[model samples]
Target: MVKQPAPDTTRRSEKSRRAIYDAALALVGEVGYPKTTIEGIAARAGVGKQTIYRWWSSKAEVLMEAFLDLGEQSAREAGQESYAFPDTGDLAADLKAVLRATVDELRDPRFEVPSRALAAEGVVNEQLGRELVAKLLEPSLQLYVDRLRTAQDTGEVRQDIDPRIALELFVSPLAQRWLQHTGPIDHTYTDTLVDYALYGLAPR
Candidate 1:
């Protein structure tokens, strides 16, 4: 039989895990992904190097999980269910709400700083970029895909349209704006994107 950890032991582990996540995010933000070492994260987290190794095998793994954890924490702080999109039967409203939340998240220094560092590294490191896309970006994008599929089923979207491609109409614009600093990102901008994407710029 497998032994379960005691309640106090589990609490301590959770605390350590949170600390490690915070330290990993902070270190990556401060020094970029190339310089963020497990030893440095352990030192910042105030845990032994073995502590991190016991939970995560590589710095990439730790940083990935840390970013995911931060997203969940942000969602909770915003009174949202982690990893969920609103489905209030109004697709445009749902998309707008999510995009607004994303804008807020992008504006947050805690999220933006490390995210920019990782993104900069990803621009030059193809393997790491692919891994980050697979591990971090794809899952979030899938939520939009799922939502668009639901819209299609409800006749809110054209039957022949591809949900994945349709999503990019709104999503890609915001992503480009955020990544390139080409324009402002806010509720109005995203709302306009949703309106234009869903209804089209030309009259019906």
Candidate 2:
């Protein structure tokens, strides 16, 4: 069998990984995605370049993982068990809670700065946009899809409605408001979106 790293070595590796993540987030926020480089990350992280190479092959990979880790960190700070969406029986309440958490996250300076920079880059770079969508956005969107499917099964939603499309009814509005600065983003706003999307603007 191959030899494994010692316990202390594992701890050190973890420390280095955290440092790298922090450095990558900070640099991307400060300089934007195009200007951020692995060498800069290594320098800020106080690790050798080879250390980062051993873990990630490209700056995009490093930045992607860093953002993912930041999201997990935010979830832990919010006392969540993991990044998974809430699954309370009350679908509206669950969606509202998650959206409120999202509002908080969007308002956070650490998340907002780098996220804006990366999002701007994605608008111009089709390849990067696709990669980011696949790695980051799609997974989160799937949670909403899954919840909507459950609602359909239970008759909370119309049987013929598409879960994926139904999810966009609430989610897309919030995303557009946040990304475009067209309007405010808060619990009340998202609650309204959920209500309108589920119940419809016209009277039943």
lDDT (Cα atoms) of all candidates against the true structure? 0.90, 0.87
Tens digit of per-residue lDDT, candidate 1, span 136-189: 999999999999889889989889998878889998998899888999998999
Off by over 4 Å in 1: 1-9
Which structure among the candidates has the greatest lDDT? 1
lDDT at position 1, candidate 2: 15
What TM-score goes with each of the models?
0.93, 0.93
Model 1 residue pairs with clashes: none
Please identify model 2 stretches exceeding 4 Å from their true place: 1-9
